[model samples]
Target: MMKKYVCQYTIIRFLPYVETGEFANIGILMAAINQPYFGFEVIPSKHHGRITNFFDQLNKDTFRETVKVLRDELERVKDNIDFQTPNTSNYQDVAKMIFENIVANKETIVRYSDPRVLITNDPAKELDKLYKRYVERDFATKPHNDQVLEKGIREILQLNHLNKQFKQAKVGDKRFEVRFPFVKRMDGEPLKIIKPLHLRDKEPTKIREHGGTWWQKFVQLQDLNLLPEKVLVPYVGPLANDDSYDACESIIEKIRGLDIEVVQTSEESRILEFAAE
Candidate 1:
């Protein structure tokens, strides 16, 4: 049923009806109190498709206009209910109420990404570093270009160089933390990365010895479909560089192949594309 809805149409349309308005913010409040999900069809595809067709047949634009009028009327008298509550309340209580309503009505999911090997935290700066290190190198020279470092020191130096580029860009947002979901390797072992392991230039061997906690978290992320419609994949290396560009391209391709819409943002270009079945 869920799959049917996703296949049929992008579900963002219904969101507007429940959205708040300036003079009348009661739609959200009504949705919160009545708990719409309790009575409405849990399988959105079944009910919403019919509702959409009905609205369209009745002239969608006019129907939507009528809905706004009806909402305004409802909002005017919402306070007359028996359980009239005070406006000022605990922010936590309001937050919890909103969260519970949304969680019941919507799918919640987790997203993960690899942290910049050098910078353990903060992604915007790391993204900038990724762009500069790979982009600014002397591409014309043989020894200086495309040379994969053998020793751990060289790799660490490279990562440090990348870090400086990240720092220079001033892209670091203090609020963001890095996380990634791990899919099992071909051998059925969970993916894990240890602190010292990032120094290794090559992809680390998939093993429990690297870090069991990380592996456990990886499994946990996959087990729960906590990640909803909004899927966030973090690119660790760099955005502007050839490698990062290729990585971005490949990821976009894969995501589009699954028919998911995507928007790419960078210092230069902002492009939006959608995947439809």
Candidate 2:
């Protein structure tokens, strides 16, 4: 039987920017009526920056709201007091239901210049495709997250010049938790893990080695914040000749310096068991 969900979506586009016959494309989406609209615009022409920026804000807002709704639904299932039987099969079902709900809720977040510009279809497969497209089109862009993190790190270093302010300020006190990217299953709910564990890494050496083409090699983290309950990050000991020691040491220092408690492990067996569950 075909499954149904309670939400819908819409997508609309403006003409591509033209500069020296070159055109840039930008897409934007707004989630929920109350949240600010956001977007990203591609300016094919230098003079089109205004248009692109407008769309960029719209795109960002839509992405933000999408994340919020997705998280809320995951929590709902996680907190279900009526949950009884929990198993792999049931988990898969709940996961599917959550993905569908994301699709249904897409319309709520997408903001169109024209209210008529909306997309609607069955929540089952279409939602999955929409999410994949959103991730590919927006979140996969490297400069966004990496650049943001870099700037944040720079600020941290600069603030250290003033030991007083640095001590008073916090490092990721509110944002330090490890995040899971896209679509996770709750204890009593069923949702298929759409992406694998390896794809969640900050680096892409493995993806490149796997013969993923240039585009395919570009992996983005699924929303870790969407995971229900606690997050388990599995790490292996650093390689003998690699800079793993420095990287891990730096990470450890940062956490400790920030007074954050994080567990470090090298147990492949335990990691595998948790992922499988």
Candidate 3:
């Protein structure tokens, strides 16, 4: 039997006002002493409505910026812990230091709940479980099919050693903002927008709606001349004889018509060729 390790974690909360003492759980931080594991997960900025509603006076842009800074700090702490060759302190001590440094003296009140201990074989998995239970439960409903597609696509990117090149990117003029899920970049190559189209919804209407939205955006970007020079869309074809597949096909055609590249996720050679170029 695999031995379970003890993991300590705290829920990070954002308090709009310290006097009122009300707060919203925004993230989680976990540390496993014996395993020497440290990690963190934060609520995405897109799902910050609860924070806004909780604090009517809060500046939404400022709050989001602050959260981004805090996340960067957390990443720095994780890197330090991971690369620490000759660590002088214990894991618990390092965890506490990270928590305190992040929460110390910011305009918005950020605090962590009392550290709680749990026994788990995989600390990272436990962190995700807790995050989904607490923070994600209050956020938007993400389709399970989309989640699976994202995971699968990420695996492909990782296997090809191209994961680091892809990142969230925004491209547009001041008047409009277009967010791409993944943008691949290399020193000498033009930016490549890679989006995994999720069209496996059970409802045909939903699939059509999703497709329509992307089609509209493509048209708008074309009109504005804001479309990227290279766009790669990976799509999983729908089930055979399914009406929804028709809608999915329509979207793929629309994307192709816009001069964007489309490839099946299974087309490893094609994807790697694109990545290499």
Candidate 4:
């Protein structure tokens, strides 16, 4: 049985006028002490209307730019803490500091309720749950299309009776490492690695960033000679004529150059054939 870890989280809010004390929940930050997990999820783009309504005089562009800057800074802090690199403070303290920095101005108010604790097998999923509960009004109606590719791959594995043979695997040496989504073993030795790449994000920038990150990892693994022999990348191809499509294509080409197999999620027959082997 997997151990359940305790997580503490706070809701990030925006205050247009500090004196008025009126604010809106704009994002969430979560962290766990015993685990190296920390992340932030922001309100969806559709929620901009709530901000504008709350602060009739606020400039939408300025608000967006501020949020972007805050997110970038928070991500930088998370990276340092996650990697266990040299940092001035501990993870929880740094999280609180970043939150304070974001809400320091009069236009933005960052206030978190008393920290709430929860036990979860996956901290990331718990963060999503909190975000949906506090931030997304239409959470129930939203489709979980982001997980479609992964679900499909898992289904194929189960259908082929290969689910028991595969487990999550880690690659790389002590200096750096990455967890492959799934790995199949033959006689207790890793035989193949499976990675699911979802390239159908609504934002082109997200698609580009995801592709670039994976490409960099592939390069790193190649340099370290840690590239698996029968690696499989299951991808959800982006819509035609969209920039995301181009981004996905570029990543596919790079992975293929390394002789790793790339299979489209829509290619159900091909996926099953690969899994059967």
Candidate 5:
């Protein structure tokens, strides 16, 4: 029979304005009962989506500070678990104590939910499972997934030592604006704009619709004469089945017609070359 261990877990939340009673799930903490297993995962402020948007009306500085404090404290506790071999005889109590300690009542922006219990064979994987279930689910990953795609492209650029040349920017004239994840400016004017297009979808229509949104943005930018000298769009597409090929090709054609450069994500060389230039 496979050994099974019970774990106590809590969902970490950020309560920016306590009066509003609005709290966002920002992380998860877990500890195994009867076993020396403890782990945690917190959504980094940079990777946070809805929480950052929620902070718009609130103070960004306070949000970040609170998140850092919570993460730091969690890390400190987790390290102690590693240093001291938790007594197996009392580990069940230790797990509950730790969970309760973390969720204790406090006036801070950080808060935790009531303790929940689960049985798992792997503590590390279960911690990740809880984070995704509690944190990512609360944010709704539709657009968040698109942001994740853009984030990956950013990591690729940073790895190639070409990230410094571009920065997040709004490219448009005074009357209109569209945000691009990576942009190069010339004389304070939008010079080269690089955007990651996430076109991978279960349905082809959804893919085309997303592409159309960007296509319209490009058209308006060109009409305003604010279009960058060069636009590099690295897209992920051509779904596994044959049905998506036509939609993918059509969208690519539509984007390319605006005199914009479109590169499939598989073409890493092209992306690096565009950024390097």
Candidate 6:
């Protein structure tokens, strides 16, 4: 019979901008509980170009330097485990101790997720599999970036104990509907919509196009009287000093022209107050 050992693993996330609470999985760290196996895999520099393109505003060196530091630390610990004193009888305990130390709660850009358990006879193969599924994940379509913005708002609401009051829903007739991430309803009909818009695109034209799409939806929904009584849009985008700020603001102004509420995504107080009403 092939022996199976239990293992624990966590994703290593790279948060380019901690303020937004958005992160990307850059690596995987897997450690076995009953064996002397502990290994890690991180995205190499060759693939960092894709990350740089996605986070265009970031300093390319920021990620490189941080990841290098983490990798070096992991290596140091792995080396220590190899030269343990004869007094040390339990390699598993050493691996566990080292794993916990590395994944301890961190506020820095490189952070670890909650450790997850799995059973595997092969930790190295499992690490590679997880690394491919997470760190090397396909970025073109999981709606990953948009989900991050929505998740930030959801976490804020959850922290305030107001998350249960809203849900993801559509607030219009079958023919014309707009799905919102956070919505409040009255008697099964939507009364308020809390929408988080991602306008932080590298290109100004892309920002306007996205905002314009929502603008038209608002207009058409208004024409049909299906627009909710209140709409709170929390938008994230380039800064005021950036060249693309004007385009982002233009779309925001247009949405406001329609009497829709717009607030900066960072304005949690305004969003919370609006949600409470």
Who wins the lDDT comparison? 6
Residue range 62-113, candidate 6, lDDT tens digits: 8788888888988887778867722355887888888998899586788898
Which regions of candidate 2 deviate over 4 angstroms? 1-183, 187-228, 240-244, 252-266
What TM-score do all the candidates reach, one by one? Answer: 0.20, 0.21, 0.47, 0.48, 0.50, 0.52
Q: What ranking emerges by lDDT with the best candidate at the front? A: 6, 5, 3, 4, 2, 1
Cα displacement (Å) at residue 45, model 4 = 23
| RMSD in order of candidates | 22.7, 21.8, 15.9, 19.1, 11.7, 17.8
Q: How close to the true structure is residue 150 of candidate 3, measured as C-alpha lDDT?
A: 63
Q: What's the distance in Å from true for residue 36, model 4?
A: 40
In every candidate, how many clashes are there?
11, 38, 0, 1, 0, 0
In model 4, the Cα lDDT at residue 172 comes to 65
Inter-residue clash pairs, candidate 6: none
lDDT to native, each model: 0.26, 0.31, 0.70, 0.67, 0.76, 0.79
Model 6 TM-score relative to the real fold: 0.52
lDDT of 5 by residue, 1-277 (tens): 8688788888887876554345677898887776767788998876554666643355566667777888888888776766664555665566567777778967677887878889988888888987886678656744565688788788889999988889998787555567788999879988899888877765675566567667877887788898876999888886657677778788889989999999987788888888887
Q: Which candidate do you rate higher for TM-score, 1 or 4? A: 4
Query: Model 2: per-residue lDDT, tens digit, 1-277?
Result: 5332333233323322111111111232222221111122221223243433423222444434444543454456544512542443354345434333443542333222322123333433544454445333333443243334334433433454421121221111122222223223435332322111221223333222111211111111122232233233322324445543454444434333432223334343443344445
TM-score between candidate 4 and the true structure: 0.48
Q: Which wins on lDDT, candidate 1 or candidate 5?
A: 5
Model 1: lDDT of residue 275: 10
lDDT of 4 by residue, 1-277 (tens): 8877677787776665454344566788887654456788986544566667445456787567757766786788778766763343475555555544543443445565556678899989989888886666322311244346667788888887877767777676654455666777777656777777876755564455455556666676677787668777878877787756776787689878888889877787876666667
Off by over 4 Å in 6: 85-88, 138-277
Model 6 poorest 10 in a row by lDDT: 137-146
Better of 2 and 6 by lDDT: 6
Please give the distance, in angstroms, between residue 80's alpha carbon in candidate 6 and its true position after superposition. Answer: 1.2
